[model samples]
Target: MATIQEIKIDLEEKSMRTLLSAGTNKDCKIVAEGDSWFSYPVVKDIVDHLRQMGYAIKRHSKPGDTLENMVYGTDFGIATQVQRANNYGPISLKETLRSVKNLKPKFVLFSAGGNDVVGSELAQYLNHKRSGLPLFRENFFRDSVNGHIKSAITAFLEQVWQVDSGIHVIMHGYDYAIPSGLQYELAGIRFAGPWVLPAFARKAITTRTEQNRIIRQLVDIFNELLISLSNTYPNFHHIDLRGRFPNEAQWHNEIHLRKEGFEQVAKLFHQKMVEILNYNPVA
Candidate 1:
């Protein structure tokens, strides 16, 4: 059995080659889009592993994309806007379908909606709970959030089908983020985070354990929404990644996992893809 470090190094090496040779091979193109989770090394490692097993990966993810819009770029602070200038010109649902008009893809991996609720929106949700508004009014905001996410997902799926009715989509609900407030130190760039932890503090939910529970509940709501969508779409599959990293050490901060943690998550995604598609690509 390969050690975690060995697995990581191999994935990293393959990722560089696969990325460099992107769009060159057309035999086994797979499109993956969504948020930072898919844009970062987590899903990239999975793509690398898949490519090593004979697959060509085409990615459409951005670092801070939500269900409806792609964020401009890497805005390290609390992200408030979902719509922004796509400086990177990411392949969105529209672009994905357009790309596939010429050539069909086997699978689409999507991870989104986490950003829509995490920052100021989260604070608003909590504030609504404290507001003296009628029960129906409070429910309106919560329901609207879920409704928007579900509708966006439906639209994306419909577009995929319009391009190729046979395309399979693989999506995952995010794991519960630890309220660590740890600073990010990847390569040379640095950013401070654990955005939820600070947000909870600002909202007067200062107790760490209580904060964890509240955040977990919030995450559950989103996951349930995803599950419902999965049931509705025959080709859309949802992987529950809520507890993949249960400990603090596995996390880099609030929303992201460390490399080992990311590897585990990616392996789950890879395993699910192989199981569903029965993909046995020639190496």
Candidate 2:
């Protein structure tokens, strides 16, 4: 068996043809694309844990990517372009679909929409505290959820099925996060995030209790949208992770999870994969 490091391929660094020609096990091959949760720099992320569990993953993932950008094959803005240029970013979904058609992996793992809803985009959905209105601007929020997030994902799924109808897609709704103003740091350098707190601060929503409440509402709605997609599409599997990481220790920052937390989340994906593939590991 190959080591976990050997089993995982960065699609940005190497092509899918290279991965396939390297004698990767076809039965366990997986294509993964998404944001920081799957591609966090210098840390073992969900895709890394999955590789440890014996799956060969060809990953096209970059931190801070949005679903719309992935679907439309474009970077979100100047900031995203700069980040991609620096990081050697993931390819667009259209390019990924071409890979899918050739590789024909049994499963595809997608992690997106978090960047679309949170980060700098979050303030658009928030109402001013002085307005005495609902915490979220309902119409705008719903439009983003349905028109933007769902539409992009739906397009991706349809494109995947066009390549191979047998390919299943496993997606996750991110766990409820604490907006305690925590940012991920490494070696005393701030790498990414403080994703949620800035929006709360901008809206003058300060109390931890209120922050938690608002985040919970956002997570719930997002998960509900994913659940609806699962119900509608037989091949789409939605992993509801809300409240799964209840403790602050499970989280590394405002959005990403700790190593152990990610391992547990990967187990959920593994279980679903087992059921879908009727997989039995070699003893």
Q: Pick the candidate with the highest TM-score.
A: 2
Stretches off by above 4 angstroms in model 2 are: 1-25, 76-91, 281-283
Each prediction's number of clashing residue pairs: 0, 0
lDDT of 1 by residue, 1-283 (tens): 9764466466556644654564644435677777767555332344444545565566666665666564223324333586444344323656666656654667777777777766435666664324454212236445855677677777777778888898888888888877777645555566434567667666666667766776777778778887887888888888898876798877766787765665676677667767776764432
In terms of lDDT, model 2 sits at 0.80
lDDT of 2 by residue, 1-283 (tens): 7533444444323434534665765657788989988987646789888776667677878888888778876643345656654322335786678768767788899999898876668888888888899877777787778877888889889989999998999999998877868887877998776889989998998888877877777778888899999999999999988878999878888888887888898999888888887874311
Indicate the worst ten consecutive residues by lDDT in candidate 1: 70-79
Model 1 CA lDDT for position 38: 56
Candidate 1: residue 262 lDDT (0-100): 56
Give the CA lDDT, 0 to 100, for residue 105 in model 1.
Answer: 66
